[model samples]
Target: MQHLMLVPVLLPLLVAALMMLLGEERHRLKMALNVGSCAALLAVSCLLLLRASHDGAPQAVGVYLPGNWQAPFGIVLALDRLCALMLVLTSLVALAAALFACARWHRVGVHFHVLFQLQLMGLAGAFLTADLFNLFVFFEVTLAASYGLLLHGSGRARVLSGMHYIAINLAASALLLIGVSMLYGITGTLNMADLAQHIPTLRASDRGLLHAAAGILATAFLIKAAVWPLNFWLVPAYSAATAPVAALFALMTKLGVYSILRLWSLLFGDEAGASAQFGSLWLIGAGMLTMAFGAIGMMGSQRLGHLAGYAALLSSGTVLAVAGFGQNLLTAAMLYYLPASTLAISALFLLGDVMDRWRSPVDGADPYEPTSEAAPFLNARLEPTRGFNLDEEEQALVGRPIPAATAFVGLAFLLCTLMLSGLPPLPGFVGKFAMLNALFNPLGLAASAGAQPGLTGWVFVLVLIASGFLALTALVRAGIAHFWTAQGRGPLRVGLAEGVPIGALLLSCVLLTVAAGPALRYAQATADALHAPSGYVQSILGAEPVPSVAAGSTLDETAEATP
Candidate 1:
């Protein structure tokens, strides 16, 4: 059980290695490995979730030892409910994205499979590590692979924008490194579980300095989360990347949210001094503004790619704001929305890319072949094929009459609506319900009352509702501009490879909303664990066993252990 925690991270890497050894020649072997590994990972995640649910435990913490070295002396892998859930979510999205990238990889001769596997490795590592420094190392690994994928096949514009993305992330890396160094210096511990236990004992002055250090680290996270001021890099990077690359924006930003979640409970627990010192209030404000920015940008934007990019920005902000609500709210919001939203958003971005392909006027193989030398892989397809059979589903959705097949498209709109507006039955709706319920408590009510009353909450609410309205409005406007209102719609070709990912992601999205029962329950457990934090600490480090009465009483005479 302890060592099983490493399976999720190890499997993908081993499979990816197998694929890499096959090289660019055996596409069949590579495909089998890619699909097989993801399916396996998904199975692992579901098993983890089941065991987690059955134990009457929020989740068991599994530890993986390398070369049989024990904890404290060697690196370890930790798996709790949150990490397992993320592993599954990341696997699902990566599978879909890999499927979507299949044609391009075959056509262009790029090692899309290799880049993809590395990306999965990074994501799993980020979620599983028990050490803060290792967390940063994994963080860089994923970002680097993501940068490669994002810049793949786009030209100078993407490279130019990706450069900005790199610059911002590199700065963030520096800040994170500094923060970790300060933390280790002060606490004499790098293991998260150990640090959490020791944090409460720091002097008031040391606490203040640590909090200040945390502020710097938090700023770096916000940049990745795409929260307002630090968010400038996000939209540009998304716009410049390929469709499959853009799909990963969801994963990339969630890294930030996950870090914030981990840090808040692990470092700034009740044991750590003040809530004010953690600076979550500022995060909430940033989220509020981010929602508004996305809504407004959606209304004003003309390009589909940019619109999708802005949509990602707003979603990133909401997660941050909701997570900033502290343990109960953060745990609930993350458990509820993170995976579902990642599904929806990744699907939407992929759909946007498909739409671009369908409507584009570029001739045969132009999108696939790299012509430009500057960013050889960065060359983009700008035009649609002349004679292709567009799917009835896509045709009807984009068509003037809005045919019966439009159900999925309509579903997309509703998913976005429920997600952005925070309404009921939907997971986003219920998740927000959890927050609303949490807020109804004395502490919550106080935060609500003090939440800048009119402007802040109202603005967030308006942005939420308006973004939903705007997305629908844009869909309608698009129907008019492309399907019903435009000229070139006789017939278009549809491929199963193209549709499988979209459909799978869509079905899962609906399933998640409909089946929020278990999800919400799991969420509440996470919330409880996060607020009190004994669960997280115990998971990574062996928990304290209940002491026998005589043993407890004799502790006074026993020597206290010192580090």
Candidate 2:
């Protein structure tokens, strides 16, 4: 049982290494290993998720005492509900992306599986590690893997853009090191479980310094997340990368948001009220601006790649806004938006690739003069009379059609739109309903009470409504043209491998919609547990939060209860 936790982290690293041995020369071996590894990873993470939901406790795996040390001195890789759940989602998405990349496996070659496995290991390690230094180590591992993937199909654009991506993250690495070093210097500990208790005890001056370190650390996170002003690099980096690579980048933004939420739960609980008053306001404002910027960019865009890229930016805004808003809704939003946005963006990217491959001519003529009209796979070529040419009337009636594969890609974009726009019957709409429930009701306004938002909920309501309205308009305009209008171009047959992953994604969305009630209950449980993180400290370090009152002012007297 103790070692069950290691399965998610170890399996990918092992499989990736195994794949490296197989190499690209044996195509079947590479495919088998990739598919098997991901399947195993997904299965393990799901088991972990089940354990978390049932047990409702951090699963401990004291894997190695290395010199038989225990407590903070010994390393720990714990699986709690939040981390385990994230692992499940991460593995699922990574598996889908890996499977999708199979079509172009030959093009990607030897480096493909190596980088893919490393990326998953990094993500798993990040979620599991209890040590701060270990977090940095895993972060770099992830980055290194990502760098290779980014430049897998190298071109001038990827080369130049990948350089910027590396350089910026390197700078972030330095900052993270500094913050962790300062934190260790002050607390004399590197374990996250230990720091939670020690952080509130530092001298006022040290607290200020800690906050500064947090800010610097947040810079790295924000930069990665593509939050507003720092997001200048995201569009180019994401748009230029291959479809699967772009799909992985979709989750990177969430990493930053997750870290922030994790840190803030420790730093800014009701004990300080500091996290809420100052932190929430700042992020809420930034999120609003980011949503505006992304919306405007999407509205002005023409290319499918750029459109999807900007759409990623818009999803990042939702993360910030939800985090800033706080309460049960934050987790709920994360749950809904993550899968929704990933499917949406990924589907669109795959479609874009298809469009570029089979684009019809724009000169009012049929480029596919001889082609399989109804059954593409049945023939290599058709008679000149068999295919088609689009005249003016026909063109107008069908409207502009993307290439065969690209048309289906629109489903991903539609999913993304539903997520961003909070359309009905989708998980995003459920998330929106839950958020508004918390916002207006505040203090568990549902059949149950939620945390009191105080005045922040009011601010959140206004901001969300305003940005949401614009996003709605933008998406409606963007999608109506593609989905509602006729596709004048002839339909092309899609292969099973390509269609299956997307079908799975859509199927997942449907399940999420149908199961939203239970999901919300789970999120509420998650929120309740997170909001009171004493269990985390106790479970990991066998310690708990002990309040210390200021000499002159009693905490209760100074306190503003958020509930």
Candidate 3:
């Protein structure tokens, strides 16, 4: 029963390895395997979620110790409501991405299926690992896979932006190593649960060292999360990537947020003496600045991909700011917002790709292909293909009515816009409303009188409302400029495979809106579990009999223990 925890991680590893063994021409077979693996992953993730949240246990959390070794020594994988929710979300988006990529993206680059699966593996491992070292390992794995995916099409722009992406993350990785090593040296254990137990007992003299370690670690995560000053690389890097890859990359920033929530709640939540709520003010302040910057960027963006990039930053900032509040209700709301925003943004990335196709003038040549001798360098920016001509003669011609397919695409774009901007009648609005209600309700901190969030809460409220307005204004302008006022030389050619994924994603948003009650309740439960870590720690270090390992510890400990 406990072994089910390993499937999400191992299944992707197996699929990626098998795909690597196949020839490039075996595209159909590779896709078949990819789809099958994703289906299996979704199934297993659902089972894990159900098991973790089962009514009978109420306190149910699964901890799998690799090699039957005890905690603080061996690799451990812990499954709880939060982990399960993340797994299920990752698999769903992955399935959608796979289906969408089938149209042409999978073939655009070599080893797409392998890298995709590897990326999934890395995401799952990051969510499941119960220690700092493995967290760093999984972070590297995900980033390595993402580097390949970002450069999948290998155009000059892609390569250039990919180089910047690589250098930035490499620096982040070094910081992560330093932070993890510092913690391990102090705690005598890399296991997260053990670290939590040890943090409160550290001497006052060593507290400064711990803070330094945490600050370094958070700098790395903030970079990945695209928080303000450190987030300069995100827009170009994401905007330059191919559509499917960008869609998958939507969750990359969320991973950073997850790490923040997980570590902060576990290690610093009312447990660590002087370190409780450490750096939270910084989180809130930085998050607000990020949102402000994202809003301005969204308004000024020239391309749909860049607009989507700014939208992502806005979403990340909102969640980060709310998370900084440290209230259970705010955390619950953030959980709900996490999935809602992730799905909406991912759909936007996919939908943005199609919309770009519609607006762009047809060009026979690949815009992304490397052309210059210096294309391999880190700072090159290739010229993009020109779309519609705006010359007076071209504009003077009578415009054709929007085609039926084009109208449908526009409708899809509108829906995506509504969701991303938190417009009414969409899940985005609901998530934000829930968050605000949590912040300002009578039972809430600021509204209860004498709470610290008095001014801060209102600032958050104003920023949230203002960001949505900016999104609406920007999206409306883009929609009108592209779809209402202009027409391409020919009708946009959209196929069934291409349209299905977009429709499905939009439909899911609608369903999320309709079912907001149940969704919010589940998110609340997940947050409840997160804020109280005793149950999780007990599951990992206090309870249960160790399983028997079939073989002696002769192989690589982590690899052999994984299953």
Highest TM-score scorer = 3
Q: What TM-score number comes out for model 3?
A: 0.89
Per residue, candidate 2 scores C-alpha lDDT tens digits across 1-563 of 55677777788888887877774687777777877888888888888777777874433222322223454887767666778767877787777777777877335535687788888888888888777888889888988988888887888898888988888888878988888888788789988768877776667777777777777777777777778898887778878888777777777776776777666665566544333333666677777678778877877775667777887777777677766655655655565556566666666666655554434423444434434553432233333454444354332212233665556666655665676667787886777776776566544544332245667666766666666566677666756665556355545445566666666666677787888777766666666666666776667776223344563357666565535
TM-score of each: 0.82, 0.83, 0.89
Root-mean-square deviation (CA) per prediction: 9.8, 9.9, 10.3
| Count of clashing residue pairs in every prediction | 17, 3, 1
For 265-313, candidate 1 gives per-residue lDDT tens digits of: 6677556655332665777788878877876776777666777777777
Q: Write the per-residue lDDT of candidate 3 for residues 63-166, one digit (tens) a residue.
A: 88766678877888999889998998898788878888888989988999999999999999999999899999999999999999999989999999999999
Q: Which of the numbered candidates is closest to the native, going by highest lDDT?
A: 3
Ranking by TM-score: 3, 2, 1
- Report the CA-based lDDT of candidate 3 relative to the real structure: 0.83
